[model samples]
Target: MASSESSLFSMAGDSYSKYEIRRRNPNPTAAALLVIDMQRHFASIAAPILPALRSTVALCRAAGIPVLFTRHRHRSPADYAMLGEWWSGDLILDGTPAAELLPDIGRDPGDRVVEKSTYSAFAGTGLEEALRGMGVEEVIVTGVMTNLCCETSAREAFVRGFRVFFSTDATATSNKDLHEATLKNMAYGFAYLVDCKRLEAALAPKI
Candidate 1:
């Protein structure tokens, strides 16, 4: 990677920060870490944040915060929805290697993995129910495509009553503009923006 994951935070300068109104840390006990679409199809865009994403998963696990992952793939044309038309069917098919989650995300046997065909994990995947069942009131969103799946999931989580913590560095997109746009959108209305260092401090053990 040309730029380290920590450097991704430098993009969240005055423009993005100006939209931030509420600055609050996450409640670990009531929070779950959401790893969204960290699959092979998005390897290029996801590579820069893999280190930070792995660290985030480890930190949440250490803090006893349950971790959930979302995998996006179209089983068939029937499940493609608007995605098939939008990208002219340049979609991830279910049986392909691209549909598989990156093995390095530190996903464990007991961690919940939700499969969906759309941008928002909660759209038809029952992710909201799963989170509620786990007694999770807060979600820390991290993974590939900051302006797509990650951002959509974070916004959906917010509307569905979960306090969202959107990671600035642990999430990435095709370009800096889309990534920064999502950060600003999150800070403005949907979620509180967070970075790896902030998460470290928030999830640090109390004396």
Candidate 2:
């Protein structure tokens, strides 16, 4: 599992290196970490990245950047949308254990948690408004299903005028191929790809 996780980071660095630009590091004062869908439903997928994700949360906290989480779930058919049709009853229902965020995640009582019914956290969730109210101009995205929620949120964030930094090691999916593909796509246009190590250096307090 560790090797697989390591390869994801390597591939992300290699694949996105060309697109990296100068001064893209997220400014702590203007940034927030968006931990997406780290719920029990995707526990296996989230397992490998848990340590890195936790580190990411801590790093952001230490840097004085706010950390928020998104939890995806459906209350009924009224909110299911196409996810229900596509997943064929595999949807995460509200109030179920699968819909709950993993307890081990580094979330604090004061941290804001957004609930969404779609892959895009912005969809009907008022996340953008919340971030705006917080004076956040940049977002660091991390969490489960790199090809789905993370990718969708990153693209939406880009179009919504937020500079996005996507975490490679702190996010995961069912397989490495899908994960790396999202990284390539994000690097090509939507966001700057960052791993935990990059985040550490970028967010570390200056001497």
Candidate 3:
């Protein structure tokens, strides 16, 4: 694609995400923020969205909302599962710095980090149980690969009976088409689509 066309695609997604239409407003009393796969590799491509994500994290923290992050790591070929053949190269190797969350997100030591080897944070993970244990009813999903990890996790959350709030500006992807597709898919059926400023503002008044 030409540089101009790519830029146009980027602008189009930004325009579409400007509106914060949602199926439901997150109940601050029963909400959690799932920051999925915000590691070095994807985070570098999606760096522009981190400011919005960082601000959202701050608001959630102030509100005493549970903020959990998922680190995508494969310890061995056995653990790779479908992700092994789906992607062309090794990703988020265990014990490597690349597998760790980016340093700029202001993650505290007390914060929880769930390690996963798949796209959905809930897959083969204790995320569901942990949320249930916390008495969380709503999950505000944010992080990298909007069409992949974010979308899958949102749908999984919905099926598990958690009200899903998908973050438009706070989630990022390398391609605009895939990102927009996820947003539309979530808005059409699975989750309430939200943006950074609006979500932050809503949480602010209560925090």
Candidate 4:
């Protein structure tokens, strides 16, 4: 969990609810979509957001944007790190279907996949370097557990200097409250909170 002390990094009051988020057209060559931890373990919690994710991914693809997916896995006890302790020893092991990315999304041959072992994709992962190498300046985030992995990556991206755009309707958590809190926090501080429809429209190709 992130510290809530920073006002623009983790706002937790009624004022945050009044933020008016505006949609912007991200430069296709300078943006990437991060699909984080939408695996079997979070299937039920993530189901409702699949349509929105699918649409966002499709639009990104059509616009020539890179769609990067991160699958969280623990290959062995040695791979667990502090996450295991924090999760009370629970692990999403490798070679198990539980750690696999959901097949329903519109995955493409040009898409990239990065494997991670922690809550934040940038932790122990070369995600930042990879994004930098691709000339990516803005990042669009979507995936499971709005209050956890998704939120963590959004904050990480912001602090690392990437313009962060979080999909408000394309990410999910176990419950509504958890999802809403993270949305408010992100809107108040870390990223621009966008809906699927607004994003698709903003990314629409010019005729």
* Candidate 2 lDDT, 114-142, residue by residue in tens: 99999999988999999999999999999
Per-candidate RMSD vs. true structure?
4.1, 4.0, 4.1, 6.0
Model 4 lDDT per residue over 144-196, tens place: 77888999999999999999988877787766567778877887788886666
**Model 3 misplaced stretches (Cα beyond 4 Å):** 1-13, 17-22
- Write down the worst ten-residue block by lDDT for model 1: 1-10
Report the candidate with higher TM-score, 1 versus 3.
1
Comparing candidate 1 with candidate 3, which one achieves the higher lDDT? 1
- For model 1, the stretches where C-alpha displacement exceeds 4 angstroms are 1-19
Better of 1 and 4 by TM-score: 1
- Residues 1-207 of candidate 3: C-alpha lDDT, one tens digit per residue: 011112211212365543335546678889999998888766455577777788878888887888999988888888877777776375678887777688888588988999888888998899999999999999999887788788899999999999999888788776777778887788878988777666766776733
| Per-model TM values vs. the true structure | 0.91, 0.91, 0.89, 0.87
What's the distance in Å from true for residue 79, model 2? 0.7
Error of 4 at 163 (Å): 0.3
lDDT measured at residue 67 in model 2 versus the true structure, 0 to 100: 91
Question: Each prediction's Cα lDDT score?
Answer: 0.83, 0.84, 0.78, 0.78
Identify the superior model by lDDT, candidate 1 or candidate 2: 2
* lDDT, model 1, position 130: 86
Query: How far off is model 1, as Cα RMSD?
Result: 4.1
In model 2, the runs with Cα more than 4 Å from the true position are: 1-23
Give the distance in Å from residue 62's predicted Cα in candidate 4 to where it truly belongs. 1.1
- Clash pairs, candidate 3, are none
